[model samples]
Target: MTARTARAVDVPVAGGVLRVGVWDAAPDAPTILAVHGVTSSHLAWQLLAEELPGVRIVAPDLRGRGQSNAVAGPAGMAAHADDLAAVCAHLDIAPALVVAHSMGAFVAVVFAHRHPALVRRLLLVDGGLPLSAPADLSPDELVAAILGPTAARLSMRFADTAAYLRFWRDHPAFAADWSPELEDYLVYDLVPVADGGAALRPATSYATTVEDTVDMNTRPTVTEALDDLAVPTVLVTVPRGLQNETPGLYPPAHLAALLARYPAVEHVAWPEFNHYTVVLSRRGAARLAELVTAQLSLSVA
Candidate 1:
């Protein structure tokens, strides 16, 4: 397959400029506005973009993550949703189909809710629905519980890019599925810290992550979005979690109960893939591209 080059464009928003990756297709091709997960960057969508060469893929490194990491502000669903809206307006692609993974799904949910006129359909991959969290848990505890080792790495320093690559090389989730693309994605997260030489750190702001996690789990926006969804929504779930463990982020029983409450959501389960691989791997991206194309067709039909 031919590789599609993504052009980086900085869009001015409320707080600051947002760096977005645009994979252009034919001028008339359908457009997909993609949002990445917490602690992730627009590079996360590279595989998916490659799989859908006929469609225009626009992904933003949402505030506090990726290239938008320098854009300062309080991060939450409302803030992210608003940023996404600005991206649409800046690109003149409002009312576009939105495909989001992990925490990005939560942001998309609130985005679709707050700006119904800007979203035509919603495709949520492994998130959007509220996860089960202990009510007594503090924000820090909640982030730790949900993110586990992923969150812990935010505070870690790597001697160099090789060391950072080694760190992720040992991660159980990507160990088996590691590829050149994954390596590039990991390298993109490394930023030089003030410690004498270079050190690896997640571009994502820790404070913003905490705030968004708390809002996703405890805020009213997510619940309100689910309660009054205005557009067709589909949720694609994987069998494994971030660590490649069984029962995944959303256990079958738990997801079933949540889906029962929001009957409007259409859920599809793809077994044998973990949360990260569900969108990162070649096979997973192929499947996701198929789903996106199908949904886009449905929207127009």
Candidate 2:
């Protein structure tokens, strides 16, 4: 009397192989393509998938991360969007509803813009507008500030999964809430090194960081492309920045400006949640599901 586990499949794409995990529950159910943030993998949504009853969930390990790590770069938002499009095409599914968190939101936004016919709706979890970069800060300073000291502490290997998970949990964002699911996720984020110890697989390298940083700061052409897009869109802005310190990184002003431009888009602000937790926390997951399901219901009406 248990449900079936999600199926994992690999699809060949232009750049590299894509590892897609799919839950083919109901053919008529709205297919949700879940995209994780930077420095994360498909495992980010493992809990969300379990929470959604009969929805078909697809999460791909974006290029340069997870099983697609071997898949070399051009790891910008456009590239990631194209990768999602390719996956959808391979599956022969049209007009999928996309749920993307943080940096992944940028990817979904671009995909919806480029292939409007392919994306039925978009639910952005605490990421929508192009991230802004300080004009005066050098790239190095920015990376150091954002990544913290852990950015440069690239070790050849870890003693064990516990070691790596501890390092990951040590982050300021996750220091307080250490869930079992998070531990499992961090464990899979690494691979066994050649020397018999484990290191971060899909290791987020300096080059990858630089490329992601550049992409995050620059205004995506997709934002302009979606000007006339009629697909249902929602932006769930978090209460804080990535560091969880700033109270208004995803402020009402930011969402208001986007709504002013789009006119048809909907916006919601969750004052209780921070950037990462807005999508990862249990309450955040339920809120996201409610918002997305409501959108689906509206479309049916």
Model 2 lDDT tens row, 181-257: 67766776676665554444335455666676566665455566566566778878877766667754555565667
Question: TM-score of model 1 relative to the true fold?
Answer: 0.97
Candidate 2, 95: how far from true, in Å? 4.3
**lDDT values, one for every candidate:** 0.89, 0.71
Q: lDDT at 164 for candidate 1?
A: 87
lDDT of 1 by residue, 42-109 (tens): 98889998998888999999998888888876889999999998988898986458999999999999
Per-model tally of clashing residue pairs? 1, 0
TM-score of 2: 0.87
For lDDT, the strongest prediction is: 1
Give the residue spans of candidate 2 off by over 4 A.
1-5, 136-138, 145-157, 194-202, 219-222, 226-228, 251-259
